[model samples]
Target: MSIILFIILLLFLIGQQVFFEVFQILCYTDFRLIRNEESEMAFDGIVVANLAYELKEKLINGRISKIAQPETDELLLTVKSASGQYRLLISADASLPLLYLTDTNKPSPMTAPNFCMLLRKHISGGRIVDIYQPGLERIIHFKIEHLDELGDLCRKELIIEIMGKHSNIIFCSEDGKIIDSIKHVSAQMSSVREVLPGRDYFVPDTMSKADPLTVSFEEFSSHLTRKPMPVSKAIYTSFTGISPVTAEEICSLAEMDSSIAAKEYSEDLLLHLYTQFSIYLSAVKEHTFTPVIYFNGSEPKEFAALPLSHFSNYMPKEFSSISQVLETYYATRNQLTRIRQKSADLRHVVQTALERNRKKYDLQLRQLKDTESRDKYKVYGELINTYGYNVAPGEKKLEALNYYTNEIVSIPLDPVRTPQENAQRYFAKYNKQKRTFEALTVLCKETAEEISYLESVQTALDIALTENDLAEIKEELTNSGYIRRRYTKKKVKIKNKPLHYISSDGFHIYVGKNNLQNDQLTFHFAVGNDWWFHAKQAPGSHVIVRTNGAELPDTTFEEAARLAAYYSSMRGSDKVEIDYVEKKQVKKPGGGKPGFVVYYTNYSMVIDSNISQIRLCAD
Candidate 1:
């Protein structure tokens, strides 16, 4: 009886293996599974499936060691698994719902938030028993097992739904009773569902979308034909796991336009689209995910858990793990988002100053134009002095031969004043106008300089990636008198440093984040023999390449020039003219503004600001 049982267990295991092998073969054999051509970064249902699969592989059976809520909508969980320790970040932010594994740490508030404290109390030391997705939905379930107060094993379910503004993270008991959620949705907040404690946990089926993983071809064709909307809309609206990108991809694979109405497609085309859709679904079922990030030049355009053929015109960077793709994509995106949020006040200040200075500059230019007649007054005075002796007493007008132009001219005079006094009066007016022109010229230059300085500060704010970088920018603004400095007991030292990059030829290149860093980089950190580059006549970063007494390669010069263009006000331009010179040739003018430099002789090159090939180094 024991031998027969062993043979049966072996047969069952073999059967399971064969079934998976057959399924994988069927997934790869379909010729209709053409690559989809779509570009998007939204964490759709299919993306969630890929993430869930990765998490299950890396985090299952892992022990939860630490839990933190760095933001109101974010949670960071540190887990130790057989492979290694990993930090899993989950956020249900309305604007950017995200879930990924990361190694970086975020600073939390001094006092733990209420929801964070509650999670710590309940499942802080639990083990992740399973990670799964239900019915190809845009939700992940983390099944955690822990000891109760009675020392009995208790299971809990943590569900995370990525549904745009409706995204949420809910903690529930085994019986599907909602214990708490990161975001509480009352009836007033959402008419479709109410998310409160003691409420039964359920996903609202408002869309009535069919499950894509199990939907038959007949159902797909029927549902699509019923919709009078565009083909892309019909595909996403009729299927549970299909996003607009996925729908568009299906249409592209069928060689049909997504904008056309679904009713316009022939029966054969609809059948082809359904077959292609099934092929993609089969890949998801077999877990054959290819995590890729598409880039438009140096900027990340979009990311996906599967290959995006629509982004073929752009560069595709593949990653071994989906977590890595998410981490890279969101890290850059979040940095830009945070910088924009923090720099709003600074940007307003700079823009205000820029507008004021521009107005002043324009008024000064107009006033200077009014002084164009100053020379005419001087010419009148010269004629009066040359021919004043012949004027009769109480002469209201004098006619004389103007020697300068050799033409007769008329000069109006006060009848009560002598000829000499009238000449002196004209001379006085000439002197006054001359002084006004001189003063306005200087003021115009100053106003123009102020405008340029403010624009440069705006460019600096655009390139800043961290809070420390922002602090340095704030300090620069305070020093420039754009922002008022508050009274403090101690001086705030700036810890922001320049962006460091290594050229392909091993040359070290440094880019300044702001004016102060520009000054520091071009003056103190650089030697006389080093090379300097900046965008010609544009507000941009000062890029310095350390020569170390060696002749720099042409590639290094091109790379530095690219950096200068990318970090400047002309970033979006197709090509920017960059001026490069030796550090010794660059000079700071006397009483000039910060980052203002004069270089009489320099080599220039026009280059595109695509620095994707450049490698950044740690400072």
Candidate 2:
């Protein structure tokens, strides 16, 4: 049992890992699709600048045709190309790097959101003049030439922030005076330029590095060891506009493990690493590399010229670029999301039921052990009562008794009790254990059956696809009175059925699943002249016979007993007593629970589930 439980827990943990991996992949894909990067690393300002240079030669006076907020921190600008015919969507979202042509609209607040209003006011009819980046920093500036209120041509700068966690849009005047920003930072918040009206705004100072796209082989190797770090860490931390993701990619191309220390490499190996790095930079500069690569898994282990890990089996052997990784990641994540959405509640219920059953079994185990010891006292008493006077006190210990034969030749007394007293004590113990055994027979059977029923319910819930299926189950619960219906003025009518069965005598019967159904079955649906049944002192279904004026046969009585057993927690047990009486004798309890009722002059019989012997009515 413990092993089984441990395996269950392990499976759950693995499931969680899979879910998270899928979620990460979806996030990456969404980001890439919205941002529109040719390659994974193209999300930053440097890559954008390279592309901007190409687009600028063709687009000098394109007008902004559309503006949208695809995400909270992202913007999409549809601009007419310089050719005056083609429309291009340039997206700038730091989280994603791929540009996509998506036809979706964002919902606006009753009052326009700050970013919406800012974009609407400044760039609604602005004409694009040029796009530029400040060096290779992760920032893009769009120069827009527009007509002012006086119809005079003016240039306004729109800064697209691409830095992680600080991505935003800032609209500035030609004089560099901050007009307003999508996100504002006061001087108190940061000593860097305050992005509010009247304050001068400038880009944050970024660290510089020899562009990996243009670094010499000697320069790359020397700069790498200047810091005592892992080669992966050194390249990522020292590079500007280069993400850790890109640095890891670089190491993969070099075929050197990122886990290894930079200083551990021999001179020959260092030369080889530098050569690989140089070749990767040249590939990017020449646009010779593919834009996308797919991994068996979502993450790309390789980048520009680096391997992200010493271990690589989980990595795909052939991803040409990072964009493909994003696509595959999202696809897998979407699948997981759908699966999780379908099974979330049922999974929780199964886990909860398993925990409940484990605890119940443990309790039963302890009780069984206790009962075993108590039963010995009963055996001892019975033996002594029959023949204690003829033997010595020590002679009739437990070892001397033959209980199976029901004979004791000579039984002795306990030193603490006289022979008569000892015999009576043992006899009393024996009788008590017999009674307890009878009661436990029922209790254990009921508990086990309940566990079984709950497990079946869980199974049913797991595969349920439509709301109607859930509604049907919920209807059963409501009829059983597990949940109460609210009284409304609209006079809602319930369209549920009573549980139907046919006795061996061919008499039809009905049972109620809940308190509401109980009342409806016993008082409204039941013929007062028929028989009714219920489990004494327990929660169970209300059972009724539809005999009209016919007398119920013994077989019918027992058939009803089986149903009483099945509906109660005692279902499937060896036996159960079902209290049956004329339906007329049944009366609703005053101020009692919905299904709670009282009955008089009832008969009872023990019966097993064997419901197959009883006929069931169709819907």
Candidate 3:
């Protein structure tokens, strides 16, 4: 069981490592996923502008027919599209940018969540005509035309401020009367617009360098070299919207080290670098080979494609345009948010169980000490066997055997007494230390299996495109005792699946695992004349063979013995002792663990657990 847990932990760590590697790759590519869209926009504006171009065309004039807040930091808008009905999700939230489609809508309370209500009041039914961002400034604006309550056609602007530490969406009328913001700011917070009622609104100032999309090789080199920084740092710091992730990506595409100092480049090197930069810009503009980045963990620390906090660690100190960073931030933040939220409960459960199990294991260790001491009982018995009644009674001393000059001996004892008595005494001492070790072992095995099963279930749950698939897992869990049954039901007799197999000579055989199964397999399913098999000195499954008037074969008897071994805890062991007899001789103990049976006059044999070579029949 401990071995199984170690395997599980190793697998989980390996999975996390793989996930982070993939995340890093995805982060470096032109993929829109950055750690935080809001901060990215504030830091890398131009990137957001370019991204808006891709979305504006598809969404312009689209009716805001549906709205949903899938998460605290996300919004999904359903619009009628020429291709089909399309869902546009805008994640301006600092933490996660999330947008997706759903055939079924989520339930909205009488009052909506704050973000949801803000969106509905400001943008609902509005025609999204255009989306734009200032050159690399970490801000985005959506221009919409919608009818007022008075039925007048009016233009409203929803300004999404992606500025670092000041990200918000402010809604305003054409005259710039503040409607409401997703997040309210006060004069106490910043000199920027407070986003309060009747507050005047205007675009924030750009605080960074010149644009990348329009710069020439000489100007680009001149501007970059002036920074006296690494090429990656120069590009990221000089641009408003270029995150370090993008800067590094650009350098990678240019086939150069991003960390190389810009001042170290010669004129020819600068020209070649500038030319490649242009090519990369053009490729990005054309949407060629959009990359996917993945984050993976190393042995000591987990690596994220974008820093887990995209703006703080992963973003460059300076950027061309804040808008660009905003776009990447939203994309990356959304991905991380989803992964973290979905896996949160499962990880918590596993970690809590592991801690509890560790404590229980300590108790088990202390309890086993007394058992270790009593193993010396075998040594005492051996001494008695060799020296007989000649030795002093109750002597704990290890006396030398044979002559003193040549040999001294304390013989190894192999006891053949009833193991139950030794085991009971050992357990009594173990129980004194902790009564819960037995329960802990059971829970540990069960928890390990459950965690593995749930990991598989989560993958299935994610892909459940239809209600039926979702219901199956829910039903399976409830039925398997993970959840309480909610529905009322009439009590029905439960029928266990029979472990029927065909012997080498064609006789029908059945093996039972528990007491209930044993009763059904022996008394209800098998004939009285059928043969039975079980372990000789240890508790195990009840196995029965139906002869049907045919003479028994020795080969069949051997196959039955193998089945008994396969079902026992010693299942992979080389050999196990099994007792066989006619079904007539076996009787259930009046009060014992299910499968406990007393039998007279049985044949014994040692057998291995390779019984699959013998044919099996469910019927």
**lDDT per model vs. reference:** 0.86, 0.62, 0.58
Model 2 worst lDDT window (10 residues): 296-305
Candidate 2: tens digits of C-alpha lDDT, residues 1-619 = 9978975776587787765665565576466556443233435433454444544654568788766665555566666765653333333445443332233344534665677677777777888877776655667677998877787888889877766434567888899988877666665444655677778877766555756665666777777878788888888776566666656666787788977777788878878777765665564455444333323222232332223333343333434433333334444444544554665654565557667876886687566556665666666666666546665554434335566675543444567667778768877766776677667766776566555545444433432334443454455445434447667789544466666777767899887654456678888988888888876554567788888798888888887877777677565567676788888998886654455577767777766754644556656
Q: Candidate 1 regions off by >4 Å? A: 1-42, 59-90, 101-130, 143-157, 171-182, 196-202, 207-283, 292-302, 307-320, 324-352, 385-412, 474-496, 523-530, 546-556
For model 1, state the Cα shift of residue 344 in Å: 5.0
lDDT (10s digit) by residue, model 1, range 253-283: 7778889887887888888888888987787
Query: What's the distance in Å from true for residue 175, model 1?
Result: 6.8
Rank by TM-score, descending?
1, 2, 3
| Ordering by lDDT | 1, 2, 3
Model 2, total clashes:
23
lDDT of 1 at 576: 97
Q: Candidate 3, which segments miss by more than 4 Å at Cα? A: 1-47, 54-92, 97-131, 142-158, 162-165, 171-182, 191-193, 196-207, 216-234, 259-271, 283-377, 384-398, 402-487, 490-619
What is candidate 3's lDDT per residue for 1-619, written digit by digit as tens? Answer: 9978975776587787765665554453323334434233233443454455655656677778777766554556687755456665555555433222333345445656776776676568888888777654667677888777788888888776665445566778788888876666666444655667578887655445767778877788877888877998898777556777667766776667777888887888777778766776674455432322222100011111122222221112222322333334444554544544554554454356456656665565565544454434444444444554343433433354543234565533224433333334444544543444455556655554444444434433332223333344455445545556776677433433546678768877787634455666776777767888876655456788889867789999998888787665555677899888888887876643334467768788998866645665534
